[model samples]
Target: MSTHETSAREEVDAIIAGAGGWRAEALATIRAVIISADPEIVEEIKWRKPSKPEGVATWTCRGNVCMADVLKKAVRLTFPRGARLDDPTGLFNARLDGSTVRAIDVFEGAQVDEGALRRLVLEAVAENRAG
Candidate 1:
């Protein structure tokens, strides 16, 4: 892998490690789901700051597909172009009021629909490639 890709993955790993407990596990699972959805998806770390130096874990396919954040009680997966995508599975539980972005907040002990998530990732990638 390239140095940049290696660094990005490392950063994401550190973020997941820092999260600890179920949040960490959820983030790891989310990462796998995103990657498994598309082979060409690239991992990235963005929006670094003093409080969140590790940044956010982002996946891209031709363009930005989705991003994951470890919240206090949940792991949030946000799609930038979610409004345009068809979410028949109703996986999105947050940001429904927004016109652009949509998010899914996975709380502790909550069951995640891997199949639905994978389809969402595929749709996001397709959206990115279409533009």
Candidate 2:
């Protein structure tokens, strides 16, 4: 590998090593979203995985449970206010046809639209903070 490629690989390895789990990338993504949206968001571990307080749905931004799901090749990011995003890219749940409710999911082998995810996270943080 070229020096640059080697350096990048080393950096990723270091990050993964320090990240502390098999779900490190997902954890990092979620944490980046939360921190960008609200630095004050309280993070705690529940059921041995990271959980955050989403407000209103069963796993609302203010609710006690913010869901985290990981699969053999990908991770899921489910938000409590998933139904409220100003924009939708068919990236959410199949069952949610309502205007203001659903789940944001990141699946394997498909590129997640980061902009959409950011908007969802931004809105979720706002919803939770408003509570």
Q: Tens-digit lDDT track for model 1 on 1-131?
A: 89999999998999899999999999999999998898899999999899888888999999899999989889999999999989998999999999999999999998889999999999999999989
TM-score to true structure, per model: 0.97, 0.53
Please list the Cα RMSD from the true structure of every candidate, rounded to 1 decimal place.
0.7, 10.4
**lDDT digits (tens) for residues 11-88 of candidate 2:** 434443454554566545654555455444444333432342221112224553245545444455556465655555
Q: Which candidate achieves the best TM-score against the true structure?
A: 1
User: lDDT for each of the candidates?
Assistant: 0.93, 0.50
Q: In model 2, where is the ten-residue run with the lowest total lDDT? A: 52-61
Evaluated with lDDT, which candidate comes out highest?
1
